[model samples]
Target: MTANTRAPQQERSRATQQRLLEATVECLVEFGWSGASTTVIAERAGVSRGAQLHHYPTRAALVLAAVEHLSERRAAEIRAEAAALTGDPEDRVEQVIDMLAAAFTGPLYVAALEVWVAARTDLDLKAALIPLEARVGREMHRLTVDLLGADETRPGVRESVQATLDLLRGLGVANLLSDDSHRREQLLAAWKRQLTTAIREP
Candidate 1:
């Protein structure tokens, strides 16, 4: 096979891989991570099981790819939202928190929670998820620094960002598990109050 002849085949393969990855995310959201099967994902993507296997020979491989894809897409959306904010640092921070809260109530959020639960018992899942978690932390820190005009290099600023990220993660967990909107609102309000205080303090 000549190099020129192989280029088109490579592109088609990449496209198929992307479709499979997208289908995996959709399947994970529609069916819980534990419930999503290779056959189901293949059907969802309108591909044969053989084609799916060509892209991802193992379930873990598919799950890892899906997580990576989801993380990248979510990070892009969040950074775009942050960039579009036109207000005070505090307002931007609130907007970011609100976006995060909304995400926690969505299907992707449920998939993420499932991943976290599985990660507790599965070493491979844990290994795959750790980088995504760290990327989230790094993005949060970058957002805090950009919006608040805080010097990330400073010890105190780093500590503050870490605390804020911890609070956000905790809030996400609460929002995911709770079904009561009023309760979620109350908790979110409290969190906002705390954030407001932190941002406004001299």
Candidate 2:
């Protein structure tokens, strides 16, 4: 086959791969990891089963790709939001906290929980989550250091920021399990108060 003839075929293959990845995410969100079969994903992508298999031969490979895709998109959004803050260090920190809180309480949070649940039973899923979780932690720590002007290398800085992140993550999970917005707001307010007090301390 000529290179010129292969170009269109390559472009079409790339498009099909992208569509399959997108469909995998949608199926995961709608049906959870266990229910997201290759057949269902192919159907959702409007591609043939053979095409889906050609791109992602194994379920683990497909799920890993989808998870990586989601993680990258979320990280970009978080970094962009953090970069957009314009204010003093304290204000920037507050903005970062608020942005993280929103992320934890929204669709991303729900999707994360779904992935976590799947990870418990699927070794590939669990393996995929490790680096993504580390990246998120590193990014959060970087944002905290930038906003607070803290030396991230300092003994206490990592602990303090990680504590705050842990609290927010827990709040997100709690909020997801319950339908009470008032309780969620109360929890967030309490966290804000704690953050303010921490910032005032030597």
Candidate maximizing TM-score: 1
* Tens digits of lDDT, candidate 1, 98-166: 776666566666666667777888898788778877776586577656655556554455676677667
| TM-score for each model | 0.81, 0.80
Candidate 2 stretches greater than 4 Å from native: 1-11, 127-136, 143-149, 196-202
In model 1, pairs of residues that clash are none
Candidate 2, residues 1-202, lDDT tens digits: the string is: 8999899999999898889877887887788767878889999999998887888888777777776677666667787887788867657666777887777777656666777788878887678778876776687667666655665554566677778878878878777656656876776677766665565556
* Residue 131 in candidate 1, Cα distance off native in Å: 4.2
Question: lDDT (CA) for every model shown?
Answer: 0.73, 0.75
The clash numbers for all candidates, in the given order, read 0, 0
lDDT of 1 at 176: 62
147 Cα displacement, candidate 1 (Å)? 4.4
